[model samples]
Target: MKMYLISDNVDTKTGMRLAGVEGVVVHEMEEIRNALDEALKDRDIGIILITEKLGKLIADKIKDIKLNYHTPLIVEIPDRHGTGRTPDSITKYVREAIGLKI
Candidate 1:
């Protein structure tokens, strides 16, 4: 099993490349979708890392794939610009789920 990446920026792609993960950079929704489809077709790919920005462009499609398929686990990763999530989002989620503050 191998990990593949679909990034929105050259920096992210380059960074991942140094880690030995091969990937492509795409900016448009169509290109992102096409890249995702191509990644899905590869049986050797067990994980697909997509930048958060690109993932947002096709959130529904990714959700559907996650629900219907078992292979090629899709993950949303932050880019060089950093994460789009609020600083306390994970804390908030934990509190909401367990009713505890950390």
Candidate 2:
């Protein structure tokens, strides 16, 4: 399975590059839509790791993509300068999936 990283910040993009991500794309909002559209075409991409800030900015789009497509697990990871933890939206999904309250 392949992994992809997307971030708008240079530092975050650099960090993901240093981490040995085979494919990394740095994009602004307009570019992000096209990038995501192209990236989702890869059947081998099993994980899509996105920066928290960007994820929040495109939450609705992400949700729509998830509802439409079942592959390529979308994960919201904090940016390099960030705390590097799962965001609340992910946590909420996990909780709801397991029927837990927090």
Candidate 3:
């Protein structure tokens, strides 16, 4: 199984490449969708790393994929500009998951 990345910028792709992962940069919805579809078709790819910005841009589309498929698990990662997640995002997620505020 392999991991592939769909980054929003060249710098992020370059960084992932240095870490031994292959990826591409895409900015538009159609472009990202196309990249994701291509990545999903490859059985060898078990995980797909998407930049946070791109993920946010197509959250509904990605949600549908997550609901319909099990392979090529998608992950949202920060770009070279750094994390876009709120500091409390993890706490919020945990609260939602456990049905209780932390």
Query: How do these models rank on TM-score, best leading?
Result: 3, 1, 2
By TM-score, how accurate is candidate 2? 0.73
Candidate 1 structure quality by residue, lDDT tens digits, 1-102 = 999999999999999999999999999888899999999999999999999999899999999999999998999999999999999999998999899999
Off by over 4 Å in 1: 94-102
Cα RMSD (angstroms) for every candidate in the order listed: 1.8, 3.3, 1.0
Please identify model 3 stretches exceeding 4 Å from their true place. Answer: none
The residue-level lDDT of candidate 1 at 101 comes to: 98
> Per-residue lDDT for 1-102 in model 3, tens only?
989999989988888899999999998889988999899899999999999999998899889989999887999999888899899999999999899988
**Where does the lowest 10-residue lDDT sum fall in candidate 2?**
78-87
Candidate 1 to native Cα RMSD, angstroms: 1.8
- Measured by TM-score, how close is model 1 to the native structure? 0.89
For all predicted structures, in order, the TM-scores are 0.89, 0.73, 0.94
Best by TM-score: 3
lDDT of 2 by residue, 1-102 (tens): 878887767777777778777545555787777777777998988888877777877889899888988888888777657654556865788788998867
lDDT accuracy of residue 25 in candidate 3: 92
